[model samples]
Target chain A: MANDLVVAPMLVVLASIVAMLALRPRPRAQRVASVAGSLAYAVAVGAVAWLIVLSPDAPGAATYQLGGWAAPFGITFVVDALSAFMLTIAAVVGLAAVVFSVVFVDRANQGVFYHLLFHCLLLGVTGAFLTGDLFNLFVWFEVMLMASYVLVAFYGGPQHTAAGFRYLVLNVVGSVLLLLAVGGLYATTGTLNMADMSRRLADPAAYGIDPAPVVGLGALAFATFSLKAGLVPFQFWVPGAYRSAPLPVAATLAGVTKKVGMYAIVRVYFTVFAGATVGISVPGAAGASPLAFLAPALLVMGSASILVGGLGAIACDTLDEMLAYSSIGQVGFIAVPVAIAAAAPPGSLRRLGLVAALVYALHHALAKSLLFFATAAIRSATGTHRLSDLGGLASRAPVLAGCFFVGSLSLVGIPPLTGFFGKFLVFEAAARQFTASSGLAGGAVIAVVLVGAVLTILYTTRAWTRSFWGRRTPAVEGATVRRSQVAVLVGLAALIVCLGIGFDPVFEFATAAAEAALDREGYVELVGPAGGDGA
Target chain B: MKTTARIVVPIILVLAISLLLQGHNLPGGGFIAGVLTTVAFALIYVAQGLDYLDSGVLGQEVESGAGVFEHRSVTAFRQTFMVGLAVAVASGFAALLFDEPFLTQTFVIVEHLPLYHELEFASALAFDVGVYMVVVGVLLTILSVVGAE
Candidate 1:
């Protein structure tokens, strides 16, 4: 019974998708089932988290082998603290986005495979988070991208179609690269199961494996992940895709799917590849592990993403596009700490770096999704998200504006809010790295974070002042906000506030997740890949 | 083209069914078989027309001027896709009911039962059939819709 809980989230979502599809002709019933399924998903995720990682007698990690096949032969799903924490974030944002979608999207449009695709997206996310095979990860990524490709072009207008096409092309290319990398890895490492690969890579001599090809293969894989995470140089698709997609779907893209990329980075690099003892000669990165190769590259990309995303956000005219750009920068915030953690030796500083990254990711997921939901609320009320066409929403719709205000303040990292701790922990990681390392690299990271924080404040405030304040335009004045949409926004806003106020447990959860992420031995032991030399 | 398609389509479908049935142990499987079946359909559509399956084969009156989405075949294809998904997921859940891991499969061999003599019935065949349905449904849907476009 306890073992069954491991796959419960995925099963619940699959059932929801089937139920929704069965009820496709009945829009009302389908909508209700969608919401009910989302609720069930959240509950299933909660059960997984509690039983697998959080309970007093919990093992802190559990693995379920699909088809009764053991690791190295079967697809494995590992529910560890890291995965559980990430799934919790997905559940929060996913439920909010789905509930918001039911109310915000028109009935006619909702009937056109909207709920179906949305659940498919969730299903993909769940599979990606749980699966322990490298090829399975690629499969899940395709599953996720396939659903999103349609949702992005759901409106089927010219701009939407164009954006979706570009998104599809770029991701197809990314998927190809990912497949190449996965194939290359299988050839190089002789296994696709991450746990088995890690074990083999850890003792290459015993396994007769060459660790050199992995360096190039790892970079190839990293590029695809960076593309998925919407990091710099690969961030071009972010704004157009987010702007074109339905607002709630955009929220899922920004809040949940982006984190899937980040989660993959942490899981593959930190847990799997971190065990590979390889010599790397990257200048700033000094270690004998693949992470050493990752550190410098990640640092440069993370910093650039921060600057590029922030600058882009500040110049955006529409609220959706601005939030889209903001997410790129927020992902940078997540990536920077991961870079720092990759650079740092395994110790307290490393753990702190991971904790900072995880917390920032959680905060960004909540804040950005809340803000997107607020944008959806305003759009539902006023029929526009362009900043120039809107004004005095504060006066027109106080609750909606208030929800947006909370979201914006959280984005700006104001005191007693979730973003404050996210930013503070990130800064603390950089600052501590500065003192401990006594190197130019540490100083550079701190400088980048400081600039990024200021840029965050700048764009968030620009978005707030331009759209929510001043005299009411006709659109704003005539706006009639949907109560349910606003209610969803309010609920998310309340969760953000409550999480921020009661930050202790959240911090503890993040710390455990970080530890789990860095626990290579535990991951391998949990999965226990069979048919190996028992070394 | 019509003569060739008429001759090849049935053979291709038979081969596809063989591939699907032998999927549990042999080289061929649901995905390839599904693709082959779709290819057979594609040849027929190309030789005859999009409405051939409905107007000629199924002996139904074609509603002229109706969009491809309103076409009965397209709807059937979509339903096939949905059913396929449900079947695949249900097959996985069936394992849980039997106190096995999700997607766990088992088989039983019945000896001297009929003309087939020893017949091997594998649980994996159900999963393969689901995959076969999904692939055929999705490909045909895309084919017909995009073909119309």
Candidate 2:
């Protein structure tokens, strides 16, 4: 029973996909099963969280080897504090997005394998989070991307196809790079399992490994990850893809899948590569670890993303486009602290930076998904997501508008909202880094955060006022929002508030996740890969 | 083309089956064998017309003015995909029934069996078969849909 719990989330989603397909002839039953399955997935994630990390007497981390094979020979599935935290974020947003999808997507479209693809996305995310093997991570990434590619082009219109095609082409290139990097790492480190690689990388002399090629390969892999996360220079696909997908699916794309990139960064770089004592030499960076080399690159990408995404959002004409661009900026907010953690001296400050990133990721997931669901609600009622066509929505549908209000305020980092805490921790991390370093780079990072915050407020307020506060436009007059969609928004809005109000436990959870991200020896011990003898 | 397909498809089918059967300890597995089988069908479709499988092979009337979704072969392929998924997942769950971990496999060997004198059945074969079905279903669906377009 204990061993079974480890793979419960993956199994539940697989069963859900199969069950939905089995009932494809009956749309009503299939929809019901989709919802029920999403709920079950959330429950399974919660159970894994409790048993593996949160509960007393919890082991803090556990690994399950598939097919009764021993690690690092077998594919290992790990449930640790970091993955559990990320999974919790995915479950919350995924459930809301799936529920919202049933109501927002047309009945005809829902019958066209919508539920199945959604579960496939969840399964991919779950597998990516839980897999302790490098090659398995790439496989899961492909699974996630495949589902998303179809979902982005779900409408099959010219514009949708165009956006989806661009997305597909870019990601195919990214996947090729990732595959090359993985193969290169395997050759260099002599292992594909993450734990085994980490063990070997920590002591290259014993394993007859050379860690030099890893720097270039790691950069190759990071480019793919950054593309997935929608960081700058690789974020060209963000707005179009988000605008083309079904609004609810866009929410999942923004709130969950983007974070998979962030989670991978933390897991692979910090947990797997941080222990490698490689002398990294970049132009302006100098350190004895790969994290040092990544710090400058991540910081630059993150800061640019903040500026570009914010400016793009400010100029967007539609609500969904604005949110899409905002997602890029929000991910930057998540990435900056991770960069800080990477550059820190691997102590309290490093842990603090990771905690801040995790907290911000959770906040972004809830708040962004809430806002996307609200946008869907507006479109469902008014048949337009154009800011110009929407007005006096707050007076027309007070509840829906209030939910939107909460989401926007959270985005703006107003007090007693989840976004406030997220923003606060991010600034806190950046500020501490600035004080510690007291250098030009540190000061510039803080400045970027400050400007980014102000830009966030500007765009979010523009959206709120333009859509929700002005005189009643033709689209807004007599528009009746769906109660079910509004209910989902309200639930997420309330969750954002609740998480902020009762932030202590969540903070502790994030701290534990951060610790888990940095605890390389503990991870190596948990998986316990045998030596070359394969005993 | 039709004559060539008629001659080559059977050989390809035989080779595919042999590969799948010997996949447990050898180079060929469900994925490769399934792709080979799909290639055979593709040859048949290319040599003959798309409707040949319905009108010529299955002896069913090919309905005019019907979309690919309404085609009988396409529906069968979809069902195959779903059933293949269920079978794969169920095979993994089968280990749980034996109090082992998910996807754990075991084998049974029978001595002095009939004319062969020995027989071996590995549980992993079930999973490989499931994969074979899935690959066939997915590829044929894509082929038919895209080919029709």
Candidate 3:
């Protein structure tokens, strides 16, 4: 009976998503429906999220048996504090995205792009949060990624179509690896339900299974997710997709797609693996051997991502392209806390790490979305996206400049802004690194992350100072900015500020969420403690 | 050309859906099926005028989000079916089901004589059928669209 509330929002989003196929209307009417449906779903999801967080559920184990199914058997929908925290942010961000999409979609293109795909995207993302099954998560990924493919190439011009092709290839490769990992997990565990896997894997000593299979699966899973996270070698598609996508699509990709990977990291590492922070012996571990190699590797890779992504951003000349590079860097920033958590054991850092990751994700989603929209407006008025052709726009568009400034400030982690706290927490966690040899390693990684932050400031400042602050140039290709467009940027900027001021509340919420994740049983209980998170 | 796009759009979509639903049990699951459908949609829009396709659409895009694709799909569904290859696979279970006991097999009979070769049931055949659909539908759709281009 209690499950009704938790599953309602998810069902609502899914219903709306499916309903997209049936709603036939005139071309203009279809456009309106697409936009309106996205907004409605976003709002409805948000309302449900708010209610869930306010409910006085106990800290022990909160669960929801969706569709009257029992856990560890039937599919489940969970809403622990951690999931709730993620859901709330995703919902709000989703709403903002729809608002941007209303005006951004090309009229010549698919009318149902907003109507069906947007709802589908919401369904994928919201489903990602609520489901309790590992395979179910993959299902959500498919929904999210498939829709992304269309939106990324919505304009279907030569440039975007080309970019979409690259994106498609990379995504397929990742999905393959993910499938392999799923296969391996099932082979060893004999069950795909996450809770059962978590419980069974927790005491591998008693399960009597070889450790090589799990490690192998984890490695493959890492490869798949790392690609999605745009880590080191797997990052080729990140720039192209984000760069070529229409402004709103870029915003969603930078803000949404990457988060799915990060979310998976937490889902697998902490909940399923319970902060293994080390390797399993069944793969055959000796005394004080390479058990902890996984954690260190994550740290190193995360550090590398920050460096590469920062350099990439600094080198880009187009505003949108630069944002794409910056997204790579931001993803690294989010991954840092997880890497640190892996390298370090349970301590003060874990809680702060969770907070840092969540806060950074939330702030970046808002800031990045705002920045991308601003870039769109800039392109509309300027007729070009190249940085070299753009300068001295303060006179023509101060509001955009202002939006860019606020978003930049928060994103670059300025004081009292929403972005500042996440970095602050991550840094605090990094500062407390343990292990004699890893002390220096952890220390170096932290230094690299900080430098990445500075690079973020440098590039974004360059963008702002040039695009918005410079003197107005004579008539260029793009001219006459729209107030309707400017309104979108302003609205997002306001959100960044409001969230910034309310950081304390946000921090508290994230901490509780972190506690839930660190303790896997709590999350397992939410969706049914036994069932999966899929349809 | 207009008639071609209109007729092909729904056909491709139907083909794509068929490919997708059968994919888990046979060969052509989400991606290929989705792609086939979308390719068809894309083609129709291209063959017919956007206006022609637009006029026939019964409602606004998908009822929920009022999305751009369904609207465009209405017009371009034939041509656009080239791209809607993505399937809403629940998380990652299409493959996971195979990981269960007995290797997710079904009994099937094939090419038999009078005694016992006439027919049989097989689960692996179901899975293979799924794989076949995904590959054929998706590959055919992509090739056709790219060929048209």
- The candidate maximizing DockQ is 1
> In candidate 1 chain A, what residue range of length 10 has the lowest lDDT sum?
A278-287
Which stretch of 10 consecutive residues in model 1 chain B shows the poorest summed lDDT?
A: B56-65
lDDT of 3 by residue, A1-535 (tens): 3335555556566545534554544456665666666666666655555565644563333455433446677665667677777777777667777667666655555464455676677778877887777887888888888888887776678988998998888889889889889888888866677877776676555555444466668778887888887877777788888877767767877787788788787777777766232344532222221224446556667778888889888888899889888888888888888876654556667666777888888888888888898888888778887877777777667787788889889888887778888678777777766342355666686689789988988898888777666655553323687888889888888878887888887887787777877776655444444333231
Winning model by TM-score: 2
Model 1 accuracy (lDDT, Cα): 0.92
> How much is A395 displaced in model 2, in angstroms?
0.4
Q: Score residue A412 of candidate 1 by CA lDDT.
A: 85
Off by over 4 Å in 1: none
User: What tens-digit string does per-residue lDDT give for candidate 2 at A102-141?
Assistant: 9889999999999999999999999999999999999999
Model 3, A26: alpha-carbon shift in Å?
A: 2.3
On a 0 to 1 TM-score scale, where does candidate 1 land against the true structure? 0.98
A55 in model 1: Cα distance from truth in Å? 1.5
User: Whose lDDT is higher: candidate 2's or candidate 3's?
Assistant: 2
Q: Which parts of model 3 have CA positions greater than 4 angstroms off?
A: A56-67, A110-114, A275-293, A434-438, A475-478, A524-535, B1-149
